[model samples]
Target: MAPKEKDDKPIKINKWEGAAVKNALDDAVKEVLTKKFNYVENFALMDGRLVICGIAVGVAMFALVWDYLYPFPQSRPILIFSVTTYFIMMGILTLYTTYKEKGIFAVCIQKDSSKKENVWEASSYLPKYDDKYNLILALIDGKTRQRRETSIKKSVANYIDVNGSVVNELVEAEVTKMHNSLLSERKEK
Candidate 1:
């Protein structure tokens, strides 16, 4: 992916820095690793097991073919064991790659619905503290709107520690206004 155009929006820090706040931020970051984002977490344990089983069967068939060609008494068993072990390892690796591909597949599906313009280039925004922080604030706002029972903003407000509630209130209002505008536009269409 190419670098994204720089955002002109000012980077704003609302909270005080502290060990507790850092830990909370770290935890919140980890939340992105779930199926909601990473997608691999949704894989069933059986998928891995099935891959192992398939490998075993394929290795057995290969061993049989090798034995038929060589017809050696001493080398057959050793060859079979080695082939089985090697194939098992390779099979496990292949299965893991498949599992990872599934996650990417999920991401691709969600990518289409994410944003029409694709202005938020995650690659460019991820490394900068300011961009990442603002992105998190936006995510919290959107998530909080989607699930009213769980206030993502309230949960992390202490960590971000914007001086007063005013900053957060402003963010909420903006999110709501944008959401309402989108709804009204859709209704008009």
Candidate 2:
């Protein structure tokens, strides 16, 4: 016999707990491994550049100031300003790349009802299973590269179904793997 049908009512998804977050990440992963190499590519380049440039600029700024016989402390505003600006510039570059690679990232990060509604609506069609797999995979992918969680959420949101249990299970299996990975990662850190 078939499993009892779950009501069409959208489950109250507490993103902070249980399999919801993991499943979401899994679903995006399915897409990432399949349709979104560009997203990953852009992220890798953007992040790698951000980290490298951030450190380089920070070092150069300190070196430039250190060489100066200025009557200011090392933590003076000017020195701080220079370094801060470099970080800001890096942040903007990251944002631009992120926005270009993954449209409307702001929606997923917001805490408002509208954001939740939109995320759910956008993901309404992608049932528990497939979405679970794709999302879990994507989140894991992002974590490996130091990606923001919301980016994974946005990617997961893009590929959703209303109710596909079997696919959700496949996705769930992957999600479980991601969860295990995450726990181990935390332990390692």
| Best candidate according to lDDT | 2
Which residue ranges in model 1 land beyond 4 Å of their true spot?
1-126, 131-167
lDDT of 2 by residue, 1-189 (tens): 877665333333444333665444434443433332222222343465567577758766775766485646754766666667777777766776565434221112112323221111012122454433223122322233343222123333332343422234344344445545644654566
lDDT of 1 at 19: 34
- For all predicted structures, in order, the TM-scores are 0.23, 0.30
- Candidate lDDT (C-alpha), each: 0.39, 0.41
Instruction: Indicate the worst ten consecutive residues by lDDT in candidate 1.
Output: 117-126
Q: Against the hidden true structure, what lDDT does model 1 obtain?
A: 0.39
In terms of lDDT, model 2 sits at 0.41
Give every collision pair in model 1: 14-161, 15-160, 15-161
Q: What is the lDDT of residue 84 in candidate 2?
A: 72
What's the CA error at residue 169 for candidate 1, in Å? 1.7
